[model samples]
Target chain A: MVTRPPVIAEWLVRQTAPADMREALLGDLCEEFVLRGSPGGRRWYWKQALVSAAQWVPASLLLLLPGYLLPLWLLDRLWALLLSSIPLKEDAVRAWPMLAINLVVACLLGAAVRLPSGALVLGAAVLILAASVRLPLDYCCLFLVLPALASKWPARKVKRV
Target chain B: MKEYLGEFEQLVMLALLRLGDSAYGMSVRREIEARTGRDIAIGAVYATLDRLEGKGMVASKTGEATEDRGGRAKRMFLPTAAGLSALQASREAVARMSQGLELEGLVW
Candidate 1:
C-alpha cells in the first residue's frame, strides 16, 4: 500500500522557496518537527534559545545600560586576567587586541541580525550559552530574551500620504 | 484579450481540469507531479492557485479535513467558465504554432 501521498512531501518542499517566504514555512516545520521528535526537549531548547535571547540582549544592552556595562567590563577584566595567567603572555597580548577582537565579533553579530543567516548565529549563541554556562537558568533567559526581542521588534512604518 | 499563462500556471490549470471537482491543493500537486514528473513546491501551487482564483479563472472552497492531514482542511478547486476558455485558447495556440513542424531528422 502506498503510504501518505507524495504530493504532501512535494508540497512541503515547495513551501521552502522565494527565499524571504521560506522562513515562516521553515519555522512552522521546525516547530512541528520538534513537537513530534521530542516535546520536552524542544520546549527546553526553545525556552533557552528564544526566550533568553529576547531578554538578555535588550535588558542588558538597552534598558539597564550602566548595569550591563558594569557586568561586561568585569567579564572582560576577568577574561584578560585569565589570559594573562597563560605562560605565553607578552605585553602585546595584554594590550587592545582581545578587546578589538571582541568588538569586531560583536559588530559582526549585530550586523548578522539583519541577514537571513541570523537564525544560524542566534542558534549558535544559544548552543554556546547552553553548553558553557554554569547557571542554566540565566543562560536560558539570555538566549531566549535577546533573539526574541531582536527578531520581533516592530519595524517603523512609513505613512504613504 | 488573451492573458498569457506561465508554463507552471498552464500545467496547474490542466491538472485541475483533469482532476475535475476533486482538484484541491494536495491532489492538484500530486496530479502535476505524476503527469509531468516534476517536483513542485506546495507553496507555489497554493500561491498560483490563489492568483488564478483572484483572476476569476478558478474557484475554491475548503473541504472536510481528514485524519491523515493533521486535521487540515483541504482547499478544493474547480475551473470557472473563463478558465476553461483560457485552457482551450492556450491549446489552440500551441496546436497552431506547431502545425507544420517536421521532427524526422531532429535528434530523438
Candidate 2:
C-alpha cells in the first residue's frame, strides 16, 4: 500500500490561505497568475481549457453541424435562394463563408463556456442576429438554453438524512 | 505580544535553530521531514523561508553552486535572535495551554 505524503494536504491547504486578509492575498496571487500566464501556473490553466474544448468541440459538431449542413444537403435549391436573398449570389458565395461562420460560432461558444458573463453579451448579439434572420426558434434556443441549463445543475447537492 | 508563527514557519525556524550554520533549503527540508514525518513541497518551503527572511526572523546568504541541483546556488539560512525568541515564546505558550490537561490516557 502506498502511504500518503504527510505534508501534501498541508501544502494544498496553504495554497488557499485563511478566510481573513491572507485569503485576499492568495486570491490576488491567483488572479495575477492567471493574467500573467506564468510558467508556474499557465500549464494548469492551459490543460483545463484544452479539456473543456475537447468536450465542447464534439458536442458543437454533433448538434450545430448537422443543423447547418442538413439545410444545404437536403434543401439545396432553398439553401441557394436563402443565400441569394441575403444580397449575395450563390456562385459568388463560397463554402468557405459558411465554414468561417461555423468556426466563429465555435470560438464564441468556447469563450462563452470559459467566461459565462462575457458570453452572455455575445449570446445576446447572436440572439438578435438569429431573430433578424428569422432562424428556427430551436437554433436560437440552442445557444442560450443549453448553457443556461448546464449552469443550473448543481455540482454536488446535500440531502438531510 | 508578537503574532504567533504559523506551523510551517515554526518548523522552518526550529530546523534552522537545530541545524545552526548548516541550514539550507534541501537540508532544512530534509531535517523537518525526518523530525515531523512531513514531506513538504520544495516550493512551499522556499516561499515560507522567503517570508521569514522578509520578516527579519531569519537571515540567508547564497552559497556556491552545486551539481545535484542543476548547478543552482544553495540559499543558506540562519535563525536570528528574534527567531529564537519567537520559537521559545511559542513553546512556552503551548506548554502553558497544556499545563493542567491530563493528556496521558486520553485518545487525543
Candidate 3:
C-alpha cells in the first residue's frame, strides 16, 4: 500500500456503495489523500469522510424508505397471520423459522432497494450481535428484517436485443 | 413537473458536462472545488452522483484501470438527456425568477 486512504474510511465507503464502484471511489479518495499529504492530510481525510457520510447516509435512507416499507408491511401482515394461527413457545425452535423469514425478507428488500446483500448483512449483524446480550430473539428479528441502508448505483436493466 | 435540482446537483452536473470525456469521480470533485472554492468531500460527490444516476439524470461507465490509482478503474460520469434538460431548465428557471432582483450590492 504505497499510497492508501484511511482504512476505516475506505471500509465505510466500500460498505456504502456497490462492489463494482468501491475501487474507483476509494482510488479517487486515495489519490486526493496522497495529494494532500501535508501536515493535516489525515485530518482532512477524516473530515471528508465524516462530511461525506453525513451528506449521503440520510439521503440514502430516504431513498430506501419506499422500497423498504412495502416489503415490511407485507412481512408484518404475514407474521401477524402466522402468530395468530401458530402459538408456539418463544424458543430457538420458533425463533429459527422467524429468523429465516426475516433474512429472506431482508434480502428481497435489499434487492428491491438496490442495496447489496453484504451491506445488509453487515448492518444487521452489528445491530443484532451488538445488542444480543440484552435483546431477545423476537426483538432481534426487527433488525434482521431491515433492508440494506446505503447508497448504491442503479440496478442494471435488461433490454431485449 | 419534475423537481428542480438543488445547488450542489447543478454544480456537479455542470462539472461533468464541462469535463466532457474526462469526467470521472476525482476530476468532478476537483472541478467543483477549483471552480467554487468550496471544499467538498469526494464521498459526498459520489453519493450524489449515485443518486443522480438513480434518477436517470446521470450515467456512468467503467473505464480501464490506471496505474496511478492503484490498479482501480475510473467510474466516468456523463449527463443523460434528462440530466442536460433538467440542468438547462433549472438554469432558465433561476434566470427567470431572478430577472428583476435588485442585486446591485450583493455578492456576484
**What's the CA error at residue B9 for candidate 1, in Å?**
1.4
- Full-model lDDT, candidate 3: 0.68
User: Where does candidate 3 stray beyond 4 Å?
Assistant: A18-20, A63-97, A112-161, B1-3, B106-108
Give model 1's DockQ, 2 decimals: 0.06
All candidates in order of DockQ, best leading: 3, 1, 2
Assign candidate 1 its CAPRI class.
Answer: incorrect
lDDT of 3 by residue, A104-160 (tens): 665566666565323554445445553756655564555534534333434444121
RMSD to true structure for each model, in Å: 14.0, 17.9, 5.2
Ranking by lDDT: 3, 1, 2
User: What's the distance in Å from true for residue A128, model 1?
Assistant: 22
DockQ of each: 0.06, 0.02, 0.49
Expressed as tens digits, the lDDT of each residue in B1-60 for candidate 2 is 775687789999988888888777657767898999975644456557666766777777
- Residue A94 of model 3 has an lDDT of 46
After aligning candidate 2 to the native by TM-score, how far in Å is the CA of A139 from where it should be? 29
Best TM-score goes to which candidate?
Answer: 3
By descending TM-score, how would the candidates be arranged? 3, 1, 2
lDDT of 1 by residue, A1-161 (tens): 22232333324332223222233333333333344455543443343333323433332233222322234345557767877677763554444325544444433454343322123234345546455645345434444444333334332221211
1 against 3, candidate with superior DockQ: 3
Residue pairs with clashing backbones, model 3? none
Q: How would you encode candidate 2's per-residue C-alpha lDDT over A19-102 as one tens digit per residue? A: 111222223223323444546445433333334333333443443334333332334454455665676565674442243344
